[model samples]
Target: MRRVQRVPLDEAARQYLCERQQYARRLLAEDRLRAARFWKDMRETAVFTPVLTALEQMAGPRRRCMYCLDSRGSDVEHFRPKASYPHRMCSWRNLLLCCSDCGRKKGDRFPLDDQGLPLLLDPSADEPWEHLDFDPETGNLTPRFDPTGASSPRGEETVRMLELDQREELALGYQTTYKRLKRELEVALSAGPLDPSALRERLEEADDHGLLPWCLRYGGSTLAPFSTLRQEHPAVWAALSEAV
Candidate 1:
């Protein structure tokens, strides 16, 4: 998963949103129409744009959910439930671009810390790899161990809330992407003295969810072909890692 930069709303769109947020709040008080209109506007502007871009940027070019690092993201997810936090309904940082499968599984459940900060890291606001880790051989996602080596709290919650480790399709998707990345690296290595910039661009273009960052920054360094590159060609590995 990655952090996505939110699109700045134009004056017109911005004003419209402010007005609508109030309108929805009023309607919500009466328990009618607000949900529909909110959904309507959300769909119309397609909240996915900024949300997706943020995910792309933060996640490295491999655009999987920050939580699962699987599934090709297809929806803008709300880190905090919009219904519960109307105050942040139009807040860009509160949104996440995720797959429908993750969205459905995560529906409206906002797990929080004792102090009330969200347990799930905001992909847009934080570097998820800091709180999470990937298991390459098995392709399972889990919390990153801390300096003392215990699983990270945020990572554990993110995994449970999004069901990252349990989703069959998500696991399969990550597995496929991982294999493809490995295969590509092997081909590049065979070519000898690979151009890191050119290869990075090529990989970025090929990535479906703009997931090149994760590959270069995290997945590439830890996994095969990538591991081979790191072991056999430090300069190339450094170049690729630095590019992200």
Candidate 2:
């Protein structure tokens, strides 16, 4: 998953959400809140339409799932399960765009640490690569190993929660995106001195699965053609990484 920059809602949309939150709060106080019914009503509102559009825009042209970044995001997913956290049901920050598969798999299963912090990665709030690692060979996502040789708990939980390692179709999609990026880098390398802006544009276009960040910032640095670029062209690598 990529780090999704949460976009701000316009004044009108923000006001609508604030009103919805007040309604949700009232229902919750009376213990009469039903998450499904509340969301169904909210979904029918004109203001809610803009919220969905904003989420789609955040997912780019494909509008891929926020959790997997694979498959089309067709529905609004509750980051904090609405059933469990009714107060946040209408909260803008608690919503995300997700695919049906991910929605089904993640249904109401919110795990938390001892401190009551969520164990699952929040793409909009956290950098996934910090906890997760990619295997270029197997095309599976796994927990990054820490300096102490223990797998990152958050990464492990996220992978397990999303079944990132077991899904065949997801792995294939990630592999395809990785190869496309690799090929682009190889072609750029063969063409001598790099034009920083041009290379950035090309990589951004090719990065459908959000692997570019992983390549430049994390485990991908040790892998080729990234490794070759880093060693053979330090200045270019620096410039490219910075631009990305």
Candidate 3:
């Protein structure tokens, strides 16, 4: 998963969500809220359309799942499980775009660190590469090892909860995108430097799985083509890195 900037809901949508959340809060306080039923009722109505629309917009043109970045994000997922945190049921900050597979895997299973902070990496809120590492050969995602050789707890939980290392199709998609990114850089390096703007655009177009930051800033930067680019064209490398 990659870090994504959260798109703010427009005034009208924002107000609607606030009002609905207030209503949910009231229900929860009165002990009358049934999490599934309440969300289902709201979900089927025209009032919830804007929330879904904003999530799709946040997911970009392909509307890929915020968790896996592989399949179409067709479901509205709650960052905190609605059953456990009913007060946040309609809160704008709680919703996420999710695919069927991810939704199924993550069904209401929210893990938190000892201090109550979330253990699952929220792509919109966290830089995934800080906690997660990608394996190019195996096409799997694993917890990032720190300088002390300890794996990231959040990454470990995220990968386990979402089955990131076990899914064949997801691995294939990541590998495909990684290969495409490598090819683009290799071709650009061989043909002599292109304008930084043009190189950035080309790389962005090829980065379907949101792997650019990993390729440019994380461990992949130490790899062959990227390291070559960094040495041979410091200006171009710096520009592309800053853009991502």
Q: Estimate each model's TM-score.
A: 0.77, 0.97, 0.97
**Cα deviation of 233, candidate 3, in Å:** 1.1
lDDT of 1: 0.67
Q: Which stretches of candidate 3 lie over 4 Å from their true place?
A: none
lDDT value for model 3: 0.90
Per residue, candidate 3 scores C-alpha lDDT tens digits across 73-137 of: 99999999999998888888888999999999998899999999999999889999999999999
Candidate 2, 82-141: lDDT as tens digits: 999988887889989999998998889999999999999999999999999999888999
Ranking according to lDDT, highest score first? 3, 2, 1
Q: State the displacement of the C-alpha of residue 237, model 2, in Å, after optimal TM-score superposition.
A: 1.5
- Higher-lDDT candidate of 1 and 3: 3
Query: How many Å off is the CA of 130 in candidate 3?
Result: 0.5
RMSD (Cα, Å) for all candidates, in order, is 4.2, 1.0, 1.0
lDDT of each residue in 173-229, candidate 1, tens digit only: 666666766677788889877888877766655554324455666644666667788
